[model samples]
Target: MTRTRKAMVLGAAALVSALTLAGCSPAAQNDDSSNATTYTQDEIDKALSTPTELTFWTWVPDVQKEVDLFEAKYPNIKVTVVNTTGGTQQYPKLRAAIKAGEGAPDVAQIEYQYLSSFRQTGSLSDLTQFGADEHKSDYVDWIWNQVADDKGVWAVPQDSGPMGNLYRTDIWAAAGLEGPPSTWDEFAEQAAEIRSKTDSYIADLPGNDPGQMMGLFWQAGAKPFSYDGDKTVSINLNSPEATKVVAFWQDLIQKDLVATDPDFADEWYQGLARGKYASWQVAAWGPLFLQGTAKDTSGLWNAAKLPQWNAGEDVSGNWGGSTDAVLAGSDNQIAAYELAKFINTDEESALLLANDQFLFPTTTATLKNPDFVDQESEFYGGQKVNEFFAGVSTTVDKDFQWLPFMDFVYSSYNETVGAAISDKADMVSALDDWQNAVQEYATQQGFTVQ
Candidate 1:
């Protein structure tokens, strides 16, 4: 999602030189140039005689089907895909590629979290001038907003991870709870009862993972930043809603009602499978991970709405997912736009939905499709998970935007906050350190930190 822009700069310089030379020639520069450049059917046929090759980089496992389809449709265009390895490593690699000025790929999969950072680099092509406007109505407003810069649209939203609670039904039943808790209070009560009655903890609080905690804050209507146009104003992390939410999470751990585990280890996956943890606060992608990690648990798991902040409706959170962006230096801008449109629009919705790709399509028409509504999954006892996810998607807020420094901030916050949860640091000091570290990082990244 992030690029160095060194390659883009060099490419721009070369283009400027070419344009300048062409302009100097009397025959090359003329008022009738636009008219003369129009390609006839014969000319178009000649152009298609030689295929254009494009390189695509993506992290999504479901992208293969789309790639195959695209190759089939445009035999003249060769599409080569490279799978991304790590989420954090993606941006840095992109940055380095741009710096090297030679290894940059034609198209890259960019996650929503890193979109702001990518846009700030000014290396991505704005698809608006190249026919993206025609498909504007096809995507959700919020998803479109994620890719739009002040100049124009930067990417196509391929998919999103709508929030949900994936829990073990057997564990809830054992705790004397009939169904998933609807409110935070009910969730807390159930957690307490579950802890007292059963050996399994209600959830695992991996202190290093700030995603669940951030989700809790957003569900309580707290935002880390407020934007007016392009300017951003930092919001108080100690706001009443944030404090209450933090306290709720802290109290669960402090009261021994939730299992505190180390982040990203064999123990975490093993614990989840053995029902040492009862539920997970995750997005639609949770089922995919569960399918691989908890295969033995089979029919024991089910999906539910995330717990509301104070027993109200409309409670959900956005998590990890990638979008596609075209580079500004691309020679085949029109071709790139066409491919982007094909994936994000209605063309691939059925395949995306059927594959359990966790792609909650942004297009409203795609949502209205019977294929989306009638979709059934054997994973959750054939309960029509897509319908449940569609309901959650409506609550996503357009105003919620991530900061360019989110990666830096979140990385530091997790470390500091994790220490606090592990009893190695106090909450007040940890939060103070987290804020100071983020501000310093922002400064280092050339931001005017206040």
Candidate 2:
């Protein structure tokens, strides 16, 4: 939910030049920010009743159920939901449509990481125009904050992926272990002991997924990147706190106590099913993903919060989450807003997303619903997995943010830091290289580095 906390940007003599290359000038953003168009209830009713059409771009499969609910309620407004390839593939097409001045949808699904980039280009409609700020209480504080900044509410909260550790209690019980560790110091001790005693490593760090690593950094309160939703940018992958994470994993990787495997591949999926790893440090969405991936090991798994940097800390971090943002280019503003608002805030539609689609909830009301959280899982010894992660969602660090040019940042990381991890090389040194590369990219892209 954190937009930013630390001052991480470097200064240019003045704010300038690259974002304008995309045609979003500072003046345009000022117009977007200052013009909060509040509508009367009559205006809202008329907009909903008018025969209007909206194109919605999303990657969520079978989300049409929610859209159907919105259509049934509005009767006059018709929505066409267009599913795209998830983020990496979808974002470029979205940007291209904006540049070409056509083909972009009225409402689009956007991850928290990419929200800053679209916001930088002035491509997102300010939901504040329709009094979006008033519904802030509907979501968890941290999740709500990620969709908002001083500019305006950029998106409607949809789903979230707060991180937690899912471990094999059966594996630990064989060594007389009762539960997961409370602190990372204890985790390391157990990781080594488990490797020495069993056939499994405690977990495999994903060498290819920086998002998972960033979630770890978030838990440690490292300020990896910061942008003011304008020209100023900051990056510090090698910050003292973040370096601790790099060094700690380095020790485990070098000692052969943890495996750095490319995630979401055939070999990785096999590793999970066969118990090559005893735990997964994954997002709230992970429990269900693991359930389906490791059906052979049903009733052997359990969930817990990530081990803290210091004992007794209740901090966690988010790995994935998305919002429904209406594009600023849309002609159907009110209808678009209604479609976004309905799927997320309407209890039936929201709960349908949770119960049927298995998208982890962002709305606090849905998160607290007894029917949503009280369910037991036969796959994890009847544990109330939703109840556990719903609590974890509340503990996620509230000040984390992303760079506006994260597309480049993420690709570059795979070559530098991610490459080093796969080679089992010095992550601390690699962090420095990643830092230099990102800073150089920022300057070349015309941001005022902080």
TM-score of each: 0.84, 0.92
Q: Which residue pairs overlap in candidate 2's backbone?
A: 1-142, 2-398, 9-450, 10-449, 10-450
Residues 135-241 of candidate 1 have per-residue lDDT tens digits of 67676666666676455677887777667888888888898889988988888999998998888998887877776666666667777654232334353556677
In the range 284-361, model 2's lDDT, one tens digit per residue, is: 999999999999999999998899999988999999889999999998888899899999999999999998889999
Q: What is the C-alpha lDDT of each candidate?
A: 0.70, 0.89
Best by TM-score: 2
lDDT of 1 at 73: 70
Instruction: Show model 2 residue runs off by greater than 4 Å.
Output: 1-35
List ranges where model 1 is wrong by over 4 Å. 1-50, 149-151, 226-236, 353-358
**What are the candidates' C-alpha RMSDs?**
6.2, 8.2
